[model samples]
Target: MPRRCTRNRRLVLVVLFVAALFVPALANAEPAVWVVKGPHATVYLFGTIHALQKDDPWRSPKIDAAIQQSQTLWLEIPNVDDSASMQPLIMQLGMDQAHPLSTKLTPDQLAKLTRAANSVGLPGGEAMFESFKPWLAALTLSIAPLMQAGYDPSTGVEMELKPEFVKANKPVKGFETAEQQMRYFADMPEKTQIDFLSSELDDFDSAIEKFKQMLAAWSAGDVDALDKLNNADFRDKYPELFQILVVKRNQKFTTQIEDLLKGDSVSFVAIGAGHLVGKDGVPAMLEKQGYKVTRE
Candidate 1:
């Protein structure tokens, strides 16, 4: 249905989708893949880039054909409403009361967090967000720099695709309700949140650079590049987290995709491009299930 990433890291999803791989560790980039077997419910996997330079090349012709052929547009979460939905959870997720923020982290880490926060124009870290899940905060922090870099969520592809989908009266469906999506945060263990926050806050600039490199790979449909950018180390360190946000969801979405291809629904399935490439990615998963997947 849609693509998701570790935690609520929508920005991370954005990064992975566009910034896929490199030739050294990664093989190469390729174009969009398709599985339009039946005339009824075939799905055209159109990977999406939510943020881009206004001049970034929209180079995939197969993707454009899928978009034109599909009857409706779908997305991960419906809108930014999830941010509002996530506020309470974020507040509750603060440094536990048993170990107040003062004791939870060293002054240096706090300072770093604040400095990172300020770099993106976010209010001071002291601002109440205790209930926030760490992953959610990481996501916010991850996207902050991008905003400063001139990326606007408002200009994201799904945002741009909405008017057309609505005008065509195409049924717009949300894969998960806002609350269900918020629960992804609610259910996370606090330690995971803190660890993620620590890692992200500690490496904000590197993450940005990684994002840049990843975008380069994704532009070429390079699955190999995507895999390297996917970072085996990160996946190993947070296996369950990665499973929940990426692999597990990819598995479920694959089922939905299968059903779509068996019907009359001409679907232009645009997800975070990351889900379509890489090992155990959607294309591979579909292939394993005996479906014929091919470059468009």
Candidate 2:
């Protein structure tokens, strides 16, 4: 072949080869949970599913009561709706067209997202998604259906924990700021993001399938099932990412919890359910340190 033709052939082969290597990692990840314990305080390690179908049972009067009795609220990030509270930070974190997420994919791959969004019956059709960031798009893909069903983020143990605490003027704090949480999206290399978004794009059917099994486990209070689903392997390999995302953040809240006990104030820390379960879970870490956690 001519030199120019040979170079073009090699380029096409390289692109195809790279793509083949990426697609399978997309299919295997699962999310789940486990529980842990500590002294002087109770940390309920609940594994949370960002999305769930309408009919799973995970009512915890214990958790409700725990929130009511606790002195503060701790979370993975400051609440998303608390935009005014974190506006400057959020602005600094925004992504733009020069960094345009879609540019990372072929036109065909992008079109698949359109079909995926439509398949799940998302609102305003195409207009609903305009000007949205890829991370927000991923967030929307993960949670909307569960919202559409009966799972209310607003009604979850965390949301309910807020109003009552605020009524008492209790302090609500986040381990990380809004910019930090949102960066989990912005920091992804373009291809990894495409992988993230693509998994979410046409994700409803698979999400629905997983929801069924997830619900069964949640209803049964099968913490191990939740842990298995959360995929401990992914957590193991990505220790640094996991630390930034969950563990190190959990450590910040632990200090606050320790301080609370000193004041005779029983504080309720509501974090992502996943944070409380497993060997790496807060409760386990605390138990190792001698805090007694009683699961209800």
lDDT of candidate model 2 versus the reference: 0.50
Q: TM-score, each model?
A: 0.78, 0.67
lDDT (CA) for every model shown? Answer: 0.59, 0.50
lDDT tens digits, residue span 113-140, model 2 = 6666676576544444454456555555
Best by TM-score: 1
Query: Model 2, residue 24: what's the lDDT?
Result: 10
For each of the candidates, the C-alpha root-mean-square deviation to the true structure, in angstroms, is: 6.7, 12.4
Question: What does candidate 1's lDDT look like per residue over 189-222, in tens digits?
Answer: 7676667667667878776687777766766666
Model 1: runs farther than 4 Å from truth?
1-33, 53-60, 79-103, 106-108, 125-131
